[model samples]
Target: MEAYNFETAIKPFFWVASDKTFSVCLNAGTYKPEIFEWRKDEGFEGNGYDWASLAKVFLEEKRPDLAEDIRFDPEADMFCAYSENPDKLKEFITGFKETCENELQIQDLFLKAEID
Candidate 1:
């Protein structure tokens, strides 16, 4: 069996959107995007999972105050980032975190089952 690196496995989809600049860098983790100046500087952290899901996670993590209105279009690159209710967004963020942790646990369970 071949072992895959965690960071290397999910490096194909990571990007960043700044106020004045928008950039998309493919597999930013495996390849250096800093030299290209695609807004993926050294400080840019690659999404730890698949693209869209990671984007959502990143947004929620960075701004736990606005998670509800952060609807990412599956067919679009931009997120529908807006919300009139901060309280709802806060709730969504908390739920999203719990969902992520649950997913991690599930994955771990599956891996352990396979190993056993």
Candidate 2:
């Protein structure tokens, strides 16, 4: 059986560039019951909570350095890591991609995944 893609046309990722800063925007826009159910045991109430819980585990347990340079905006419903230095933003994007792949089990996550 072929693997199905949860989101393709409108991928859950995007790139934002401005002046000398670059940011990787993680759009967890909306999630259904399965997401809430799957992570309920982890104490995530869904939506922003899901991102927070996942980021906490990924940053604290997986990559600590990336966490320091990242920020989540609840009002905008976006998680963005920006840096004036290209190398710094690149590093953050790499670790963020790993978090989605390893933690979220998004194996086919590529292209617009914010990788250089």
Identify the candidate with maximal TM-score.
2
For each of the candidates, give the backbone clash count: 0, 0
- Those runs of model 2 whose alpha carbons end farther than 4 Å from true positions after fitting are 1-11, 29-36, 41-45, 103-116
RMSD of each predicted structure: 15.0, 9.0
lDDT of each: 0.37, 0.50
lDDT value for model 2: 0.50
How many angstroms is residue 4 displaced in model 1 relative to the true structure, after the best TM-score fit?
Answer: 38
Determine which window of 10 residues in candidate 1 has minimal summed lDDT.
107-116
Per-residue CA lDDT of candidate 1, range 31-98, in tens? 32222233234322333223344445445445555555554433222222223454443344344333
Q: What is the TM-score of each candidate against the true structure?
A: 0.27, 0.53
Candidate 1 wrong stretches, greater than 4 Å: 1-51, 54-68, 72-82, 104-116
Clashing pairs for model 2 are none
